[model samples]
Structure formats: C-alpha cells, structure tokens
Target chain A: MKIAVLIAPAVHPVSGRPCAGEADLAALALAQRLSSQVDVWYAGAADDAALADYLARGATHIHTLALAAGREVLSPLAEALQDYALVLCGARAGGGDGSGLLPYQLAEQLGRALLPDVLDLSKSDQQWQALQALPKGVRRTLAAKLPLVASVHARAASAVGWSYARLQQGKIQRKAATGAALPQVVLEPARRARALVAASKVSGHARMQGAIAGGEGKSAGIVVKQGDSVEKAQVVLDYLRQHQLVDF
Target chain B: MDFSTQAIPRIDPRRPWVLGPSGLKRIVLGDDSGSRDAALLAHGPAHKPLRSSGPFSQRLLVVAHAERGQLDDAAREAIAAAAILAGKDGEVLALLYGMQDAAPEALAELAVDRALTVADPGYAPEQKLALLQQLLQQESPHTVLFADRSEDADLGRRLACRARLSVVTDVVEIAADGVRRRQPGAGFSLRERAQVLLLARGVAEAKLPFVGKGERLQTAALPAISEQVQDLGSAASPASQLALEEADLIVSAGNGVSNVPGFLALAEALGAAVGASRVAVDDGRFSRDKQVGATGKTVQASAYIALGISGAVQHLQGIKSCRHVIAVNLDAAAPMIKRADLSIIDDCQSFISAFEALVRRERNLV
Candidate 1:
C-alpha cells in the first residue's frame, strides 16, 4: 500500500523554535511501519526549518506543496493525496489553525472515510485496521476499505531517534500549487476568558452555604483510624462501589 | 379615614412598627409581599420560566449523545448554550444520537423545547449525517451547537465539513451574538457567531432558570447509506498497560512500600495503571515516566490509591486533580492521609494482600 504522511509546521512549546509536532512524528513512524513507500507531504505556509526536522527523524521522500501566500491547502492537499491508498496525519496540527478539522475537511473533499484518533494502524486482506483512542483510556478497533484518511493519536507511537545521516540522505521536493484561495483570517490579540457563572437566585444564607462549602456539595474525607486490615479493605471496597469506580 | 382616596404606606420589614395618631403602638403583622419569599425558602429558588411565548421565529439546535440514556455534563452544557442563545422568540431543539435509556421527558429540565432522538443502533456515521442533513433542511437552525468531546467532536467536524461552514471549536464563552475560542498561540480570539459551534466543557451552566415544553418530535426512519467504515466495537486493553494520565484508576506506590512485585500485582489485580512517588523513582524501583509528583507527571485520574505513600507536598500536587484518593499508610499523621478522601491506617503490604484477596473473592462470587 502506498501511504502518505501529512506533515505540518510546528514550533517547540517553550523555546518557540521550528520543530515537528510529536503527533505528526508519530504519524510518520506509523506510516513507516505500514509501508516503506511512504511520502511526507507538507502544505500551507513555509517552515522549511521544521521540515528539516522531519527529514532528520526518518522521512525519506518529502513533498512541499507550493501553496500561494494566503490560500487554503484543502483542495491542493486533496489533489496531492489522490494517488495514495491511505492518508495519515496527526489528529491536530501543532501550530497553525489548531482546530483539528483539516483531516475531516480533507476526507470530505476526497469523499473518503475518516478514522480519527488512531493509536495504531495495520493492513490485512485489503483492509486497513485502526486502533482508535476514546476518552478515559478506552480503545475501539475500526476497519475501513482502501483510500481512507486516518488521524494519528499523540500516544500512537514514539518517533524514531533523530539521525543526522538521515537528514543528509533525505530529499525534499517542491511541487506546484493546485488549490483555491481562502478567506483572509483577521488576527487579534487574545483576551482572558471569563468563566460563565449563572446569576445566584438563592437567599443570602443559602449563598453563604455555597460560598463556605464550595460547589458540588461533596462530603468531607473519612479517616478510618480503627479497623483491622480486612475491615479496612471492606471500607475501601464499599467506597469504590459507592462511587461506581469498581464493579466487583 | 378616607382610605378609598389615600393608599396606606406599607411597613418596612426592618422596622415592623408604626406610631398611631393617638400615640398608640400599632404592630405590623405579616407582609403581603412575603409570600414569594416564603415560597423561595420552602421550595428553594423558583425557575423564572422562560417558555418561548411567541411563535418560533428562529431555531438553535443542540446536537449531543446520551450515554446509557443520560446526558453527560458536556452535553448538558451544549443544551444550555443553545437555550441561552435561543432567548424567548427562538426555539431550542436538541438532536440526540444513540440509545436513550431514559424517557425524552427528562429533557424538560434542560430547557429543551423539542427533542428528536436518533435511536438507530451501530456506528453508522454516514447514516447519522444523512439524517442530520435532512433535519437541517427541514429546520434551518441559525446555529448548531455540539460538545467538543469524544464522538460529538468527530460528528461536529464532519457536519461542518459537509456543510462547508467554518466551525468554531473549543468555544469557552458563548452569547447570543458572539463566541470566543482559544487561538493558536496564547490568547483567546473572539469571533462572530458561526453556523456550527463546538462548545468546550463548562461553557454554560446546565441549571436553567426556565422550563421547556419538552416536546418529543417524531422522526422518519434513518436514510440508508452505504457505510465505508466498520466499527468492531471496543477493544479491551488491560488498565496496567495504559498511560497514567489516560487511566481512569491508578495504583501508586511510595517509599514505604518495600515489596515492588507485590505492588505491581495489586495494580494488576485492581485493573489500574501503576504510578510511583518521586522517592520510589529516585530509588530506581520504578521508571521515570511512572513518577507522579511535582517533577513527574500530573495525573487527573478518577481514583488514585496511594500505597505506603507519606503524602509529600509535591506528590499531593500531582494527584490534586484526582477525584478520589485512598491512602494506605502506617501513620495516620501523614499528609497523604489528610488529603485523601479515605485514609486507612495500616501497613501497605497487609492492605494490599487484604484488598487483593477481597477483590479476588468478589470476582469469584460474581
């Protein structure tokens, strides 16, 4: 299967230096595991310095789609990924438009099925299987036909160690743009978010109770000072059951 | 006394007495306006009742999934956002996907004017999308609200892409006119209202000041569409293999625990992820990633069991976000015991054995 790993420009969280996102690197690693004919594709604004980081990590054939200054990459990226049987990318971008909607948009544009938050990927008998990550450490296995788009989870797989040799051997080819122009985004300074607390309608006494006890009226902690190990274990079990933490 | 022409002045509650013209004391009895206050005191605040009196001129849609027939906190928040934005003239309609274990009448508490349940089984996103598009065509809601969590996150993005509308995700604050979301870098960007809104958790108060009609709308059968993706149901991964931050339950060991193998066994028995104190990691008893403290990973697990851990300030800081903490320590004076919701004063090894035995016996019985 021919796999395409979508790469996006990323910056270090603290140093703000150009770097690859952890999830995107994970996607690249997962792609390498599935097939050796994996090509790295980058679209949008230029960040060659970060692309170099992907080269250092294990990306062999890197294609940078030449998108005009302010144009969107949906149509161009979709056209670029037309040949690949599978398209894999991080569930979210590291920097630009961190809305995590690019994959969904691409899947819709290409009219392909999208398997998101994939922790692992494999292929067997002409079908792509994905281990999807759900909330609270739950996982769901999903199967889809060829020509599918999957978004790699951040915890999917760790990227291979950086190789200075790989960086020298990797090739980054610039390709012509084939996308439409998008609307200009207006940038403004971010503002502090205010928590939306409803107007209190209770009496002054009830309001005081809320203020003193804090919200959600949970009972205070229990200190079991006297009990044998068996009895204490029973207490723990009872508490766990009361909270529905454990079934048995 | 020409009482018909002149209205009598009401007595203030602060001073419930008035001096008569004859210099006699006249005591004011119960206040006529005190009935509402009495009701408030007896029944706890009365809802302001925001039933949209006028015809539905505009509609605000809230799309959510009810797990086991109960609306999660995030889903409730989305409904509240729609209700707040709908105001009096506009109607708030909720489209629920998945099996509703409870009756639709429960939506009355959420201020939902009308609810349509998509009760079809299976993981058919395409069919659900078709139904959603059909509903969208039938009632062109001004704005569709969705919770930015779990399955709704995927569904909302899919809807936005198919509709070709730019969706504002992780919207922390929403009002009738505008919405705000966190931008790429640091600050928040306030944008004009979009057609689809993916609301973040706690963006609105679920407790409403009004009651809705709670009318359950009848829906046609799901539109048949060939689905490309197949869901094979949930895969079971043992909790011990899960990451600490992602695990719902964690069993942590501290310096007081001498038996490392026993601690690991207890964690496996309890079906929980393993965590360690900084001291335990420093002693090379556990890996660096397993450390949970100020310098280690911060965990937001629902339940955390601290075995033989004397609650160090740094260790407490990491697990502070944990919903429930059970401390098993020799000393009741330990700081962990104070921070723990339930503290059992006992040796870590004995407690582990007893707990494991209890769990095994309970499982066998079941």
Candidate 2:
C-alpha cells in the first residue's frame, strides 16, 4: 500500500522560528507505521527550513509543489494527490490560515472517503479501520475501503525527534506549481472578542439574588470536616445533584 | 421650672423629610431603584419588543445542530451575530441539522426569524452538505453563519470548498465592513466578510432588544446517496485510558492517597478520567501522562476531585478553569481546601471506598 503524508510550513508560536507542527509530524509518524512506502508532500513555498524536520522524522524523500505567492493550494494538491491509495494530513494547521480545509477539499475533489481526527489506523481484510477521537474522551471506530484521506489528531502519536543523520540522508524535490490567486487578507494585532450574553430579564431582587448567590441561585460551598465517611460521601453526592453533574 | 410657659417650635424646615408607612419607622417611600422591580411585579417579565414587525427585506442564515434539545453555546453565538447583522431591515434564519427540539421562546429571544430543521440520524456528511448547498442556492442569503464546532466546522469547510467560495473561519469580531480572527502564528487577521462565516465562541450577544418571528419552515427530504463508509459505533474509553486534557470529569490523586487501586476503582465507578499530581507521578504510582500541573498537562475539566492532594500553586494554576473542585484531605487548613468548592477532611482511602459505594448504590449497580 502506498501512503502520502501532507505537510505545510510552520513557525514557532512565540519565537517565529521554523518548526514542524505537532499535528503534521504525528501524521508523518502514523503514515510511516502504516507502510514503509510513505512519501511526504508539501504544497507551499520551498524556502521553509522546517522541511528538514520532516526528513528527520523518517521520510527519505520530500516532494514539494513549489507555489509562489498568490496561488491557492487546493487545485494543485488535488491534482498531485490523485493516484495515492491513502493520504494523511493534520486535523488542523498549526499556523498560516489554519482552516484545516485542504484534506476535505482534496477528498471531495478526488471522490474519496475522508476520515478526520483519526488517532490510529490499521489495515485488515483489504480495508482500513481508524479510531477517531471525539470530544470528552469519547472515541468512535470507522472503516472504509482503500483510497481514502485522513487528518491525524495531535494525540495520534508522539512526534519523532530531530536527527542530523536522517536530514543528511533525505532528498528534496521541488516543482513549481500555479493555480488561483490568493484571497485578500489583512493581518493585524488581535483585539478582544465580544462574548454573546443573553439579555437578563429578571427583577432587580432576582438579579441581586443571582449576584449574591454566585449565579444560578445556588448556595455557596460548604465544608464538611466533622462527618464520617458515609456522611461525607452523602454531602458530595448532594453537591453533585445540585449542580446537575450527576443524575439518578 | 416654668412648665406652663409656651416654648418656641424647634422643627427645622431645611431637613429632608422621609415618609414611611407610618411615622414611627424611618423607611423611605417611592425609591427609584425599586421602581423596575415594582413594574416587573405588576406586568410580569416582559419580553423585549420586536426589532421589526414583518415583511423582512433581507435574510441571514445560521447553520448548526441542536445539542440536547437546544443550540449549544457556540451555535447560539453565531445565531446572535447573524441576528445583529440582520438589523431591522433584515431577518435571521436558523438552519438546524437535528430535530427542532429547542424551545420557540428561546429561538425568538435570540431573534431567529425563521427556523428550518432537517432530522436525519447518524453521520451523513455528504447529504448534509448537499442539503446546505441546495438551501444556499435557493435562499441566496446575504451571509451564512456557522459555529466553529466539530460537525459544523466540517460541513462549513466542505460547502465552501465545494463551491470554491472564499470563507472566513474562527471570526472573533464582526463589523459592518469586515471580520477579525486570531492569526495562525501571532497577532490577528482582518478580512472582508465573506459569503460564509464560521464564528469563534463568544463573539456576539445572543440577547436582543426584540423578539424574532420564530416561525418554522419545512425542509425537503435529502436525495439518497450510495454509502461507502461504515460507522462502527462509539465507545467510551476507560477512565485510565483517556487523556487528562480531554476528560470532562477527572479524579486526581496526590501524596496523600496510598491505595491506588481503590482510587482507580472509585474513578471507574464515577466514569471519570484519572489524573495524578506531580508528586504521585514522580513516585511512580501513576505514569507521566496522567500528571496534572504546570509542568504536566493543564486540565479544563468541568469537575475535578482531588484525593489527598494538597493544592500546590502550580496545581491550582492547572485547574484554574475547572468549574467545580472537590477536595478530600486530612487537614482543613490545606490550600486545596481553601480552593475547593466542597471540602471533606477524611482519610483518602476511606473516602474513596465510601464514594464508590454511594455511586454504585445510586446507580443501582449493587
């Protein structure tokens, strides 16, 4: 089976230095585990120093579709990734637009099944199965036939460390590609976001009560230092019941 | 003493006089601060007057799924943003992906003029996307809003990409001219509002000065498509197997907990993820990934139960976002006791067994 891992240029959040995103590196690591016939593909400017990090993580060859400024990557990526049986990418980008739409777009354009936020992958009975992560520590398994795309969750695997030896052994092949012009975007310093609050429609007394009682009209916390184990447990249960965290 | 002699009146005319129910009490009458309360008492809780009566000129769309019979927080924010943007001349339309179980008054309170619901079971992204595209083509709304959540995010990106339309996602602020979002590396990005927008949480106030029409619209059935994907049902990972950062409820241990198995069993009974303080991790009783502190994984669980854990500053910092903290310790003067909403001074082992027994009894598992 052939596997392709998609990577993009990432910079450190604080220092603005080149570094591989944790998510993308996990994708590479997962791809390497699936099959040894794995290749790393990048669709951006070829000047990124972070490309070497991918090599150290175990990709022997890096294929770059060198896109100059003002070209969208969807079309070029969709075209270049058509033949591969399995394609892997990060659930979301660590930097840049970070919309995490490339994998979905490519899957849609190539007419392939897309499984996102995949934490583990394995092949059996000529089909690929994945363990997908959900919110609140829940997980769901999904299965689909060959020729699919998956976005790797950050927790999928621990990223491989940087090695100078592997960097020397890897190869980079760059090919200039062109597509649509970039959309107009302007970057600026961030401002505070406005929170959406439902307008209060209570009496002044009710409002005061809410304020004094710490909202939701619940009583303040209580300390139970003088209770036995059963009584203490009962108090805890009552608190949980009041908060609606547990129901019986 | 000249008691019979008439004395001059000692009343001062400049003094402020307050009239009470009776002359004996000093209570003041007609207080302006309580006027609102009085009015509410007379008329009950009145809804805000409608922004517009009818005959809307334009329309904005909000797409989301009803979670547990109501729109979740992120979706409500998006709806509110759309409502604000619609103004008096425009109308806000909500497109829901699940059953129309949200209360009508709640929808009206958010200024949702129209609601269209499509009820389909399971994971059907393709059909949902197609329905959305069809609606977009038909309505031609001024702007479509979506919450940047798990399902909506996927649907929004798919729709935008399929149509090749420029989209703005994770919008933190919205103005008449453009939207703003925190950029990838640092700073923020401001871009002209696109036809489709994915709003970040807490961007708009869902409360409005007026109620919406809150009328329901009928939805067309989705066309059947061939199924190539198989969903293999969801499962809850064991508490010990789950990562601390993603756990909603966590049971953590510290230096005070000696019975690790008892702690684990209690966590399992509560169906909570397990975590450990740095000291416990260093002691090799728990692995490094289960550690919760500044050097460890900072958690944002809804409820954190600390067993025999003295709250260190770093540990407190890690649990700053937790809504509820319950501590079981031997010392009432411990820092953990001070930070916890509920504190119990007891032996960790005894408390663990007692809590577990209560949980099992309450759940009727015994």
Model 2, residue B220: C-alpha shift (Å): 6.6
* Regions more than 4 Å wrong, model 2: A194-248, B1-53, B109-111, B118-120, B205-213, B218-223, B252-263, B275-351, B361-366
- What fraction of the native interface does candidate 1 get right in terms of contacts? 0.64
Compose the digit string of candidate 1's lDDT tens values, residues A1-248: 68999988776778866788888999999999988888899997775666898999989878998777778898889888998879999998877767899999999989899999999987778787889998768899889998899999988999899999999998889977867776555565666555454454445655554455543313367888787899999999999998777756
Give TM per candidate: 0.81, 0.79
> In model 1, how large is the Cα lDDT of residue B91?
94
Q: In model 1, which runs have C-alpha deviations exceeding 4 angstroms?
A: A201-205, A220-232, A238-244, B1-56, B66-72, B97-99, B103-113, B117-122, B175-177, B205-224, B253-263, B276-288, B291-295, B306-351
DockQ of every predicted complex: 0.51, 0.49
What is the lDDT of every predicted structure here? 0.81, 0.80
Q: Number of clashes in every candidate structure?
A: 1, 2
> Measured by TM-score, how close is model 2 to the native structure?
0.79
